[model samples]
Target: MTHADTPAVQGGPELAQERRLVTEIPGPRSRELAARKDAAVTRAVGTMLPVYTVAAGGGVVVDVDGNSLIDLGSGIAVTTVGNANPCVSAAVAEQAAAFTHTCFMITPYDGYVRVAEELARLTPGQHEKRSALFNSGAEAVENAVKIARAHTKRQAVVAFDHAYHGRTNLTMALTAKNMPYKHGFGPFAAEVYRAPMSYPFRDAGVDGPAAARRAIDVIEKQVGATNLAAVVIEPIQGEGGFVEPAPGFLPALLDWCRANDVVFIADEVQTGFARTGDMFACDHEGVVPDLIVTAKGIAGGLPLAAVTGRAEIMDAPHVGGLGGTYGGNPIACAAALAVIETIETDGLVDRARAIGKTMLDRLTALQADDPRVGDVRGRGAMVAVELVQAGTTEPDAALTARIAAAAHAQGLVVLTCGTWGNVLRFLPPLTIPDHLLAEAFDLLAQIIKES
Candidate 1:
């Protein structure tokens, strides 16, 4: 049978897997909607591509302008089961028809319990675990911090450089970016410390173990383990450009956390599910976090996030100390359950590894010929290229933006990110067709070369 016949195939054979542009990038209808959006929507809200989407399945997004573009962003890595996944959609419809939200904090539902059980089973470590659901990655992250502080009786939380936790007040403090995510937005939460991350691309000769030492030194001298409650990080840093930590860095950091009683929280919001080839990125290093903040791919595009970890740590938060009115809404829980099933039954974990191999091979080859391509790094479907001034590691944000814009114009949706904003990240849904990925990469390579 063809790949499309497998459970791993996105949407189905009926969905168009090709990119077709009948008009300019933003056709008249999308332009009209854009004008409407300018009038009705807040200016602060931004879009990567201005085209208005109508339907998306498999690897293609159909826009209102009748143009179909290859979706490489996966709505910022949320639709791992693919947009409108059949299983998830069916579950959501069934749950929504029965009941939407009774508030798990008020009248708990079985779906929430089921999702929590699944989370406990899937997250790293075979220990007894517990999970709390929330509405966003930021909520899960904030809740994780609360749980850590409650357990350790410490107030300071350490986040790494080049990390993008979220936009909430606490998560914004956790995040490292400034221009768009943090500029003028805070008076951020205090007692949040920044530590050096293992950016092998920028930090010369710093391997994983050595990088861990550097971060540990900073936390010891600057924050002190006594005052630190947690060291939160994205195993494969997401918005900060799919920056995968050095091999030994995470395990070493976890060891230090255990020794000093600091909670090691892995923010796998973007890398969890099957996006990183492994169910969770922490699985790569056999590092089990004290708490893992998960979202994005959790509910197959629905708004859901979770913090799953050891039972003792998760139970530290007092009753009613960790829930929200809409946390673990019934419908979202149903969706999450379906998404987990899809990942398992479809063998998306292996699919992610295959996609990663293809992406790494293609990007690595491109890097061999282009000095401006400073680095090609990532795991599974979470991959990226860091653009730099030729022969130097200096960021080329302008060039990156130009290439992204060119790709968009040519009916391919690509996203750029990084601390210096020179990284082009590719987060295609695990369900994306191989040919679609190859097509998008070809367009991207051409744009990069032309630029």
Candidate 2:
């Protein structure tokens, strides 16, 4: 039978379930490969799974050992459209066969313009918009800060605590974590400030509006609104613990930014591209950011990033200041166009919302059974469950690690994040079959219960 005609063993979407495993977790070959990887790779480049994949498509990662493990992390929310999605693969292959690079600033190309047009149309806000392409999320964020500073003619850039923008010098200054990401890498860029974020799970007494006011007050008192170029935030804090802001917090902050002449930026690198229910998390609050920084899933696994914002604000930077040598590589641009098309044609946005509902339903039930699960929160397929010590609100990092190890031992991959490192995040592909999703949750629940 043709691949399409073959019934999926997992049984949900025929195409998705067609992928399957043929060996035990990490099997024999993957163990050998892991040993080789240990020898060649630097210790700094940390890996969560022991298995190395030989192929990936749809919702499964086929390891070199012949095991098809269900993908739930989506490469830290980078492969939302799916691994080796047909449309993205075709576009990249076609572009590779043709001219690969001319550097948009050096020669220019239609693919770059097409990708920019798509960003302008998709990003939040009804105002006239423009876009600048980059190679990574850190680059987009760094440039956004540059644009905001130029437009407002201000020096200080404000970011939220627990934010994970990027790892570049400026972005490292912007990021909040101190462990692996920011360990000894200091001497970051200057004129960067941090404000408290609305973390409801931890700050129980402070409501959404109150949290926004407190954060704004700090900005006004320390940096002063007039001296601030931009106030950047991730709507639902990723890496920091899938923390969704309390209702009205974002809108309140947006209003404050508008009144103070501070450019508001939404760092949608993790939450954008339908990873959240909406196209952008800003849509949930009807908040229009002056700039939106995006990457991760923008090119369906290829490296491409962008900054979409109000036309005037985006145009404030000098012409020569915006681009880079390989910002919009032809292959990445082609893949991005196809990624957006697939997101639209395959209805992945709606699928993201549906996936969130299923995950919430299952996780909520699991939460009811396990006291270790302190909270369940997130939008669309970007869901998380924060673990706590039984009968207390204290973070249970040890238990969280055990639960993740247990799941991985069962051939299911998972991820952990949070300032306290007690959050278990689920970033399953939107195209994952319902059966596989159910199986993943079942495995997770079993592990959590046993742990």
Candidate 3:
């Protein structure tokens, strides 16, 4: 469906899009909900900020007790267009009123096809492409691997250190971290190999080409290119902290993949949409992946994921081989369609770049003052500051936690990531007001200084 034919977007709840704390961060009502959650919710299902949210829009999340916290996390980069986005909510409501789900596999729908078309058009490529929708980023990554293996008739997959694909058995194998995501989740899927990552902050004096060579060497020696089905990577590592690969790293890697007949997969789950200024993080370097897995921000805040790629590769699987019971649900498809329209009509890509400049400028200044902030990195709205010991690169995870807790207490929502858990990542919605962004950063700066 064309943008011109799209219907009007609905408005969100009547909450002032500014941060306000009438009480403590969680307040009374939220604590009550938390108590109830403890009684009912499983301990394995963890929460970052445990405040029970009543409403959220623009740049703030309002808890049940009426505290408006500045939302820098954006629900872990899922709400790039903002929480309860008008366009997406309206589409979802309309789709619900019409029909919730027909199960795209059993009965196809226009919304699903439209979403696939949009993914093909928007993802980084001019080549003929196709897409298959799923329920989560993990599902997309898994499906992408299936397609790759089927297309190449190869068994091996190459992932990188400091990479986070997902939580499924196969994805857990792809993921590098061990403590929470992989620990105790033993007997993971095999044929997945981990290579060195281009962490510029940690690997000083290592240029992009050198980093690429190091990873290529491992891939060639350990997992022969002929045996590898695909080389999957997050252009900017997400849960492992927003580690942007060096300048020439991605191009060199893509070139090697091309020459080696290995399908190159770019997992843009956290960096897709306008989160990285460009539609896809790979676009920054004009590197096109054979398959691009996207989720997170695809459907505003709905559960939707997709694998868009070269038509021939995607078509490798026979008919009825690539679908799920709830994959490409009509409501999710509607929301995704609306999200694509919102990003284009609202100029969110440019907005993300502006937000990045604002954040980088402020955080760079903060790093100048604080020796504990070892590195400030990331692109567009997906930014982070890695904390370390003064004058050294040793990660200070305790200090990072303290600063995050302090920010939460003061009604600011922040998230910590990185392999060592010392990176404070900020991912504000593209619709966030500049003033709120500035205020939240100021609050963070004050809290860091106090710590």
Candidate 4:
């Protein structure tokens, strides 16, 4: 069936799923809302586009200005199943009407257990697994570290360069970039070490296993395996320019972790669910992580995250350990269950791979024509275009910003990432129409030409 015939485009949530510009990009209503936001909300929280979304579904975000922009970011890869997905929406409504928050630790419900069961069945590997839910990716990641430390009786952790875990105190420490995420957030948690990552574009001389050896040498020499509790990595670095590690990098790292008894934590927060072509990015290399941190696209658009790992490792924490009041809220858990259903029933994993092919083919063509386009990388819907100066590897962050801004003005919701801020990341929802996808790229190509 064509995109126009899909349920999302066929009028769920009254969204047209087509890019429409009734007014200028931000328009007047969005500006008014932005003014109110500036006055009421903290300036610390930054918004990518000041358009002020009113409704979003499929591949289009309808702003208060009566403009619909094609979504390429997916709220930084959160709304994979699409914003206001019917299944997730209905499930959330039903659960909300039943009862909202009871605090899982206090009055546990079936929804939480159901989500855990589904996670065990879905995540990579058939080995006995357990799950703990949380409100955000950061919370899930932090708890994963806690569980790893508890299980291994070690304190030190290693995070890769250009990685972005979250904005919490512990996650900030885990994050590599210094400007926005960690600029003023000083005196971060200690015992967190940095390691080299395999960047195929930059480190062309080295392959995957060789790169793993580089990071392993640093970890063993500096942090020491005995002192390390976990080695945290984004299987495909999301904020780190969607950097996919070299071929054998992850498998080799998993081997080292297995040998050293170090908990290998895959932060699949951005790459989890059906965002990647595989059920999980770890599946690409058949590298099963000891602990997997998941969020972003977990519950459609609802706030829910989880740390799933081996039953033994997950059970190491004490009786009163792991969980929060809002963690695994009934409504969120219900949404998560519905999301899993949508992913399976809708066959979104294959859809994600298809979307990847469309994007990669288009981007690869653009790279071939433009020398400024340094690299086109990522798997599935999680893809990125790294910008660089012609004839050199030096990042062209300014040019990237101009391209994103131009795309935004033309009703294309593009996002920028990377440690150097020179990457344009595309994370279109799986439900996005092929026409809209093509248009988004065409617009991007035109904007690049103009720039």
lDDT of 4 by residue, 1-451 (tens): 2334222323344578678888887888788778988999999998889987667888898876678899998888988888888989889889989999889988899999999999999888899999999999999999999999999999999999988999999999999999898998789999999999999999978999999999999999999999999999999998888999999999999999999999999999999998889989999989999999999899887889999999999999999898888998889899889988999999999999999999999999999999999999999999999999997899999999999999988999999999899999999999998999999999899999889
Judged by lDDT against the true structure, how good is candidate 4?
0.91
Positional deviation of residue 286's Cα in model 2 after best superposition, in angstroms: 1.0
Q: Extract clashing residue pairs from model 1.
A: none
For all predicted structures, in order, the TM-scores are 0.97, 0.95, 0.97, 0.97
Model 1 off-target regions past 4 Å? 1-13
Model 1: which ten-residue window has the lowest total lDDT?
1-10
lDDT of 1 by residue, 247-304 (tens): 8999999999999989999999999998989999999989999899999999998999
lDDT of each: 0.91, 0.88, 0.92, 0.91
Output the number of the lDDT-best candidate.
3
**Residue pairs in steric clash, candidate 3?**
none
lDDT of 3 by residue, 345-441 (tens): 9999999999999999999999999999999999999999999999999999999999999999998999999999999999998988988999999
Cα deviation of 152 in candidate 4 (Å)? 1.0
Candidate 3 backbone clash number: 0
Model 3 C-alpha RMSD to native: 5.1
In model 4, the Cα lDDT at residue 33 comes to 78
Alpha-carbon error at 239 in model 1, in Å? Answer: 1.1
